[model samples]
Target: MNNKIGDFKLYLSHELGLADNTVMAYLNDINHFYDFFNNKNMQVKSTDIVNYMNKLKSDGYSIETILRRLSGLSAYFDFLIKERLIDKNPISFISKPKGWDKLPKFLNFDEVDKILSIFNTNDPLEYRNKILIEFLYSTGCRVSEILNIKVSDVDSKRGFVRVVGKGNKQRIVPLYNKLVEILPSYYNIRHTYFVKGRDTGYLFLSRNGNKLSRVMCFNILRDACERAGIRKKVSPHTIRHSFATHLLTNGADLRTIQILLGHSNISTTEIYTHITDNKTREILTQFHPRFRNRGKS
Candidate 1:
């Protein structure tokens, strides 16, 4: 019953149904705690928990990082308590650091157009890259989900694609017909030229015909932004945020967006409401007479 860190990982993966990435993160955090405990030869205590957190903060971890690490410890201690390994949760006494509430970064529609229009479709790679950017913005898919797509997943006739999201849950997101039109151009090249034993099942691929990596997509976005003359920081997520924001601004329902984005929790999708509210306020400020503050005789 006194299983250490290894047992906790199995619990996280099997009992909790956490994804591999989440399980890995939890294991890494607990390993840090176990290492600290072993190094000091001290038993787990509330003070030790606080001290370790303070040490992490002093080591220049951001508030978000500190909170994530603390949250992981809290979950770990909860498991221990349930197993009768601890009488009380030491992490309970640790207060979460105040998280900075910055609005999620997103590009406006014009910014998105500017970025996508940078590519000329003459070259095969350029043609495919243009389609990739269009598909991302049109579908509002996460970069991971986009890259995970298979050629068969796209139902062009239906104007939707079956996307396997977090937890391996599948959802159908509408694919704009305008974006789908680019598929044929890319498909022709993809079909003709490819590396030996390359995967044709994947929807997106590198010049070598292998599936594209996330980092490679990021660099592609960065270069596209530069070509578009956009100075603001941009990433694949920017397109996702832009997709959701544009839909909300044009009056899409919250629930539909949540389903499209494959958010397990609705609260995650609520951030766009805040963005929409801010846009409304700005519009009123610009046009409303009371807020206009015009000069009067």
Candidate 2:
């Protein structure tokens, strides 16, 4: 079973082109299933698969986790069928789990303002951190994409920045006027840290002039959030989530947000609608004439 799982991993990587993390997740889920069936000494069937899912629920696994594991099993069964080890995919008959629509965590506009305001200082490092946070909110790029940005990626004249996203795909995201105004200061300070001979084109850099790692970016945002008295866990992704949510609340369409965020599918972009719906409900509850007149009627 372990050798068969290794082959599946290779197929996922070489044939499906899945990311490393995704491949590992699939493997891990399948390994769990394998362990559950190890002592059964019976042919795996749809009933067996259903029992496994029930076990997951009984063990207090989240709906999302159960759904993900089911998906992994589906793929694994398909591979087994292709290799003639299974006559049919047992997972095919199972209805997928539903109603796990948890929205992404995002900071509200005031919270974002508070975090950014904490860096209002003359320190160059503070300026860099401020620019990093601002840029994440402005462009909605993933932290990995942002870290890959070069000084040349900024088009100050045209007010846009080019971002290379997942699958090495590139897209242009518009920069707000505020980001444009701060660009010069960030650039000047960023260049001062450059080694005399090493010309790293990456926009954000470390103290030693190396490209900024994702962990470092998370630390920057976490520190800023702490200083701003925000108790929620904050990272570069929180800023990106805030970017999309704020845009949707301000009336940007889902398609436009999808394009800006470089999402391959609009379904991925629609999560922001949940946030917008909550905002709409808040507005209606607070100021709607019907709500205000309910006591009188």
Candidate 3:
């Protein structure tokens, strides 16, 4: 059954065009469910699936998380039924959990300054790394997108870089002039580190002459955040959050920012609006005469 399910996952990836990571996640989720049932020494009926989902909630998994796990289970059962491994899909009657309306967390422009300025640019490598950090926050790109950036993708004349996002979707993000000014320095360092026909296309490289791993990028970001004295738990994604929030606070429209961030859904981009709470308070303080003048008027 495990092997059969694994074959179905491969079909989902190759035939249905699901990304590798997504397919793996689905497989893991289903495998976990299977393990849970086996440990209980019982087969999962339709009501048992519901009871398990409820148990997930009792165990403090959020509705969104439960929905994702349930969705994976449904897909797996559907595959089993189609393959005649199961008499019927047990997960067919199960409903998804309701999601909560949660806002995003982001840093202010000053906080971004605090984060970026922590890096010491005494050496060429330091300079390159600092520029890489700035460029990631300035562009609001995923870490995957940041490492994939090439010198030719940057257009100084257009002030943007063509980014290929999730699902092979492409979009152009307006480049910050400050970031553009420092890009050449990184490029110079990259040229120095270049070996003949060895990953000349990648934007960032490691000390081992290999492309920067996501884990390495994340560690670098966490170290920078600690150096910056930022109390908020920060990661590479925090820089991205700050990027979008800062732009929204500066009056960029949601649609344009969404395009710049390469988000396929407006809902995914809406998180930035929540991070502008401080900006909202500042605006009210400046514009509201009652608040500004303290009842003098």
Candidate 4:
């Protein structure tokens, strides 16, 4: 089984082309389960996985963490089956733990507008900040993808920008006309103020003219959120969640969003549906016969 772990690592890293962080995370999850799996003499059953999941919950693992572990174990078992070691994927029919599909935290449209409104100053840096935030919401991209975007990656005339996502996978997401209209001013500012040496070619630049980093991205969003007076915690990913949720609210289909967001698995993208699920409850509760008389009294 340990040797199989090594093989799976290779499969994930080399064949799947997953990022190091993702590969490391999956390996960690598998190893964490291996300790208990050894007790079953490597002949693990679905009940064994259920018992393990219960143990995880009892030990206070968050729903998100437990779900990640289950996902990793499922993938590992799938790999084993592919190699003809396992007869079946034991956890295939297992239900996700309750609340595992809870809605992700995201800003409403008004909150996003408020955050964007913080860049009212004429300062070139402020323009850059506005562009960054808008770019994030417009693209629905990850921080890594945002940092990796180069000027060449954007094709304004075509109204699409190429983005590289997890596992170095490349996909094209549409660039809104609003973003296109405002890009030139930022480009001019970037060329004049930010650049001092050889250009890094990344679209978003720091004061040093290098590509905007993850920490820089975080600070930019945080500062904007503070200025906008949004009390809730926000990050680049919050903007991402906002992007997906807002799109869903506006009636974008999940498959289109999955492509735009560069999700390798549609299931990974389905988390955003929890918001629609809330809307679902609202509609159901509003019309249900059980609720019709309650407010009347």
Candidate 5:
């Protein structure tokens, strides 16, 4: 079983071309499943897989986690079947967990304004942090994608940034004039952090001249939110959510948002529709003549 799992890992890495983190996550799920079945001395079967999912739910795992584990198990079983180790894929017929489409949390424009305005322009680090926040909101790029951006990726003349997304997929995200205006100032300050030979082409760098990490970006936003008196659990993704939500609110079509966000599927971009639906409800309740005075009835 252990050797089979090892082979699966290699397959995921070499054949499937999954990212390192995704591969590790799948491996972890498979190992946990194997441990549970091994301890029970039970042959892996459809019923056993169902019991495992039940166990996960009993242990208070989230719907998302359970579904992700099931997906991993399904993939693993498919591999096992292909290798003639397993007769059938037990998880093949399992349905996706319901209520997994909960709306993502996003900040309002007022809250975003508070966060962006909290930084003092005189302080270089704060100014840089401000730019980071603005950039996240302006382009709606993922944290990983933005952190991987190089200085050369930006086209100031054309007002776009080339972002490398998941699976090394590249997309061009347009930059707003507001973001374009602040970038030159940021580049001037960014150069001062360069060491003699340690400097890299990354757009955002730490004082040590290395590329800023994902955690560093998280902490920057967390601190900014704290300073801005926002109680919501804000991260870089919150800014991204706000970006899409606001665009939808302003009548940006779903297909256009999909392109901007680099989503290959329109369904992923359709999540913003829920937010827009709620906003529509609010507008109708406040201003629509038929909705007025309905509470009196």
Candidate 6:
């Protein structure tokens, strides 16, 4: 826990919306640099970074490994600059590793089923988790979006909920059949939560009755994944990713998914193609009008 690493971690998780694995990797890289000064001295200097990197190189780390570490360290410095904790990014001159981009991680239909089914509806918190996962996957919402939903925002009679997305933009997301079926039962249970605060009216509440935090959302999902025996680094984003990818795999078009995801640019939604390219190719071969007959005799 070097100086401000916790703050930097929060910045990465909440501000940047980084995946849990990426956030942990960045913090680990930054912590490694902090450990370089074995005396636990405070720092943010280019010279120390260079010397520590030199030590890593001398220790025979591969170029890919070195570049990845530097990328994370550079991101830390960039966060420091943004936070105004430092006026300059000490590692500003360094280049990030190329081709390091990863496709967003997603669970297939079966894995998603496992997580959804693992929670017993009899337990209140477990029931909440079940509803939480279903709601996220159904809406394809960001964690921030779903966490902000109030009871008033959902119109169960109409079968859709209003979502407030990035930049305070609001959109309506329909509840899928599975979630719609179980919601009334959840609402019955929800009425019994311990109200520790001023009754914030947020739909997702912690046992303590405060609106559930981003970290709590993460931990709940993580614990659920572990129970389901899913080894992939699962986060709330995984649900969102799975929702979009599964939709595409099942023939939902990118434009519709983009609007559902609240992405400002279709290019942002198009990234799901990287994850579902093979499936899409299958879909195209099976159903595309032009693919039905090519050079047929």
Model 3: per-residue Cα lDDT over 259-285, one tens digit each: 888887899888777778777998899
Q: Mind giving the per-residue lDDT tens digits that candidate 4 earns over 113-228?
A: 99998796489788888998888999999888888899999998888899988878789899889889878877888899888789888888889888888898899899999988
Judged by lDDT, which candidate is best? 4
lDDT of model 5, residue 73: 79
Worst 10 residues of 4 by lDDT: 35-44
Question: Where in model 5 is the C-alpha error above 4 Å?
Answer: 35-43, 46-60, 81-84, 95-98, 194-196, 293-297
Give the residue spans of candidate 2 off by over 4 A.
Answer: 1-99, 194-196, 285-288
Task: Rank the models by TM-score, top first.
Answer: 5, 1, 2, 3, 4, 6
Which residue pairs in model 2 clash with each other? none
lDDT of 6: 0.83
Worst 10 residues of 6 by lDDT: 93-102
Model 2 scores a C-alpha lDDT of 0.85
- Provide the lDDT at 87 for model 3: 80
lDDT of 6 at 76: 79
Better of 3 and 4 by lDDT: 4
lDDT of 6 by residue, 1-297 (tens): 256688888888887776676788898887787777874446567777777777987898866577778889888777777777777777775444344455777999999999988998889999998888888999999998899899899988889999977646789999987788888888878877645548778888999888888899999899999999999988898899999999998889999999999998999899898888888678788898788776676
lDDT of candidate 6 at residue 217, scale 0 to 100: 91
After superposition, the stretches of candidate 6 with alpha carbons farther than 4 Å from their true spots are: 1-96, 196-198, 282-297
Question: Residue 4: error of model 4 in Å?
Answer: 3.8
Q: List, residue by residue over 138-194, the lDDT tens digit for candidate 1.
A: 889988889989889998878889998766779998888787776776778777664
- Report the C-alpha lDDT of model 2 over 270-291, residue by residue, as the tens digit: 8888778877988898999997
Which segments of model 3 are wrong by more than 4 Å?
1-4, 39-99, 194-197, 290-297
Task: Name model 1 segments beyond 4 Å from true.
Answer: 1-3, 32-60, 87-92, 198-200, 287-297
Runs of candidate 4 exceeding 4 Å displacement: 31-60, 88-90, 120-126, 166-169, 207-210, 264-274, 277-297
Instruction: For residue 114, give model 2's deviation from the true position in Å.
Output: 0.8
